[model samples]
Target: MSIDITLTVNGREINTEVSPETTLVQLLREHLLLTGTHVGCDTSQCGACTVHLDGRAVKSCTVLAVQADGSEVTTIEGIAVAGGLHPMQAAFHQCHGLQCGFCTAGMIMSAIDLVTREDDLDEATIRKGLAGNICRCTGYHNIVKAVQMAAGQMEGRGHE
Candidate 1:
């Protein structure tokens, strides 16, 4: 049976009919045509399918589409606003945080949420905050730097 549900995605409202078993990752990538969320592992150990559900970072692969009814979702595509890259995205690029780039989308998303609403940000905090995300390339050094830089930038902007 197809289940109908409404989800606010990337600031756009979307209503979709999906199977009860349809995963949020599939819903975003297949149904909505938002392919930025990648599925690296089916076991949910890999954080390649991370996204924001109702402003909280979650692994979309572990969530069902039906579970997102009436919820707000933020994918990587939504982060860039007005043709400008988000601070996290820019930081990642500036810090050379990615190589294969397969895990970049999820890593960036997780980092953004980790730094959001945070007052204290340091290398340890950023590293621990990214504990959920696993990256094979760049060895997490640049990724951590990117998160720290993004955190500083976000903190500075919080005052403006």
Candidate 2:
């Protein structure tokens, strides 16, 4: 049986029917065609499917489509502002925080959540905050730098 769900994604309201077993990641990539939220692993061990649900970062793979109903979801595509890159996105680009570019979206999403929630961010704090998101490339050194850089730019902007 298919259930109808309504949720706001990437600042757009979406209404659709999905099987009860449909995951949020599948709904995004398959139904909504928001391919930026990658499904690296179905088991949620990999944070590649990370996105913001109600302003909090979550693994989209672990969340069911039905669970996201009535919630606001933000993908990497939504983070950009008016044809410009978000501070975190810009920092990632400037810091060379990605290679192969597979995990960059999730990493940036998670980093945005990290910067918005934390205060007085330091290297260790940033590392701990991003522990859930994994990056096989760039060794996380540059990733940390990107977060640090974006933290400054994002300050007082209240990016969410």
Candidate 3:
């Protein structure tokens, strides 16, 4: 049987009915048609399905649609604004943070949450913060640089 679930996604309220076992990644990609949140591993180790739930980065594969009811969810599609890309997005582009692009969105989302919670963003902190995410293409060198650049940009914008 389907269960009713309501959530605020990308600043918009969404109401739908899904099975109790439906994962947030399934809902975002299959039901809602927001496919930016990728699912690389079902075991929650890849971090490719990360999204912001109530201002915290979470693995959408590990979260059920029903569990996100009434919470605010932000996928990669909602990260930018009317003017241009979010700082992290721009930094990823500028710093060549992504290779193959499979893990870019989750990496950015996790780094965004990390910087939002801290004032000092250094290489070590950025590495530690992004430890949960894995990227095979870049070897994480460029990814780390991208996060550092984005942290500076976000700090300048007063996002934290």
Candidate 4:
């Protein structure tokens, strides 16, 4: 069966019909065409499908479309401002946090959530905060650095 849902995505209000079994990730990528939220692992083991649901990070694959009804969703494409990169995205680019770029979108989404919700983040804390997201490329040194850098830039932004 199909159900109608209304949600705000990337600052736009979207109303559509989705199957009861449709995941948020599928609603995003296949229906809405927001492919930035990748689908690395369908089982939610990998955080590549992460996005912000009501201002918090969530694995989109784990969230059904009905659960996101009447909610606000932020994908990687939504985080950018005025055609420029978000602070976290800029930090990732500056710190060389990604290779192959498969997991970059989810990493940035999680990092933004971590920095916004926590304070005085140390390397260990950053590592712990990002434990849910996995990067198979580098040793995560650069990812940690990128989170730290973005944390500074986003210090007073208060969940942007």
Residue clash pairs of candidate 4: none
- Cα-lDDT of candidate 1: 0.89
Clashing pairs in 3: none
Cα lDDT over the full model 3: 0.91
TM-score, structure 1 vs. true: 0.94
Point out where model 2 deviates above 4 Å. 157-160
| TM-score of each model, in listed order | 0.94, 0.95, 0.95, 0.95
Q: How accurate is candidate 4 locally (lDDT)?
A: 0.91
| Candidate 3 lDDT tens digits, 10-120 | 999999999999999999999999999999988999999999999899999999999999999999999996999999999999999988999999999998999888777
Q: Model 2 TM-score?
A: 0.95
Off by over 4 Å in 4: 155-160
Residue-level lDDT for 79 in candidate 3: 92
**C-alpha lDDT of all candidate models, in order:** 0.89, 0.91, 0.91, 0.91
Model 3 off-target regions past 4 Å?
155-160
lDDT, residue 5, candidate 4: 96
